[model samples]
Target: MDTELLKTFLEVSRTRHFGRAAEALYLTQSAVSFRIRQLENQLGVNLFTRHRNNIRLTTAGERLLPYAENLMSIWLTAKKEVSHTSQHNELTIGASSSLWECMLSEWLVALYQQHKDLQFEARISQRKSLVKQLHERQLDLLITTESPKMDEFSSQLLGHFDLALFSAAQKTTKSELKYLRLEWGPDFQQHETGLISNDGVPVLTTSSAQIAYKLLQQLNGCSFLPVEWAKKREGIYLVPDSTTLSRPLYAIWLQNSDKQSTIKELFKTPLIAQ
Candidate 1:
């Protein structure tokens, strides 16, 4: 089997779209189509159920995915075992939106300085997407705001990432606190007004918290931001009655990676560090 074909297969499986996978792989859409055709011809199985706008994995593809992924992981591990120079010198880390926003740069720097001759790639992704990338042997580590649920993953909870509500520099007096409700995912929609007492005036709504923060800086409204981010700013006043929301950070790694496990032990970072 061609190892390069496996890369294409995994990419197509990930994106479920030839065009997008091709863009990521830096190949043309037609080239991606050709690679898939070559893979299907070699394996004597159709991997995708084609549709106009979407592609789903077939039963064979579903069964083959784990086997193919494990095969790749084993190859990577074996390569790591015998080699003297570290290949993880070029490492990629994945993070979700809020993690990227409030995540400590020191965490990345600490991880980076551990290895010699290392290059880093910072990927912005959703939690599920990050998990998939990690499983595919594509990412070195994943930094997330959510705790891990699966048996295969080990999650370490770092200290709280504090967030607070902030209003414009000019708008004072808590008697009238107009708000901009900033919500990103389905999980955080409940805490709109938060502990801060708002005057029932919803200025705007957005799906991205960063956008809300920017808008709050420009307009006459308030939004919640990571306390670190808020503290760095001089103009904005922290809403008087606002409560701090604490979101814990998690460092996640693959269960089967012998290399990462050894590194984790050496770092002396516990699974539940305060």
Candidate 2:
């Protein structure tokens, strides 16, 4: 089995869109389609549901996903074990959207200055998938809010961010108990009396914190987001501090890779959480 094809398959599974996957892999749509067909023909199993513009994994594809991941890990491990000396260091890291603050830029500059031979790739994504990649040895580091378990992976408490209610600064009507906001989880949202709904159900509903900020700029309604994410809220107060919410964040990496000091150096930097 080709590792590249398997990688493409997993990428498609993560994104759930073919054109998007093609763009991500730098392959033409036809090329990606042909590779899937080739893999299916070689394995004597169909792997994807075909639609003109939509694609989904077939039952066989789902069954084979885990094995494909294991196979890729085995190959990478073999290559590392056989390497006679440290020739080059290539590191890939994943981060949740929250960590793309000013710190990311600073980290890259420091890393390059320290390790001229370093080649780095980074992506922003959801928590579960990033953890899976870290466990599989596909990613060197992961920064996220939730904890993931792995024997070779170590977790470090990074910092915290407060999730607060926000609204259009100009539109806030002084109604404390009757406003709508994004719901993260019950720990932050439980027993709160207010109007809350998805951002798009009413054709104006939005789930984006950026959009919430914009709405707050337009005075739409209050929304939920990282407290430090506010700029205009300097004067716009939210529903009393009683309803303010915050969650802890974590930075994780494979324990076995700490021998590479550049990767370790990134974690040493204070990550601004909000």
All candidates: CA RMSD in angstroms?
Answer: 6.2, 6.2
Q: Which ranges in model 1 have alpha carbons more than 4 Å from their true place?
A: 1-86, 110-117, 170-186, 193-210, 262-274
Give Cα distance to truth, residue 235, candidate 2, Å: 9.0
Whole-model lDDT, candidate 2? 0.64
Q: What stretches of model 2 exceed 4 Å from their correct place?
A: 1-88, 101-117, 170-208, 217-219, 232-242, 258-260
TM-score attained by model 1 = 0.60
lDDT of 1: 0.69
lDDT of 1 by residue, 55-154 (tens): 9999989988998887777777556444525554455678756455544455566655665455667888777777877776566678766655778877
Consecutive 10-residue window with the lowest summed lDDT within model 2 = 198-207
Tens-place lDDT per residue, model 2, 1-274, is: 6888888888887777778889999999788778877888889999888786677889999998899878877888667544514534667778754454423555667767766767777776666777877776567778766666667778888777776665545434335323444433334445334334322222234334454455554444566566666644454456443356567677788787643466556666555633
Residue pairs with backbone overlap in model 1: none
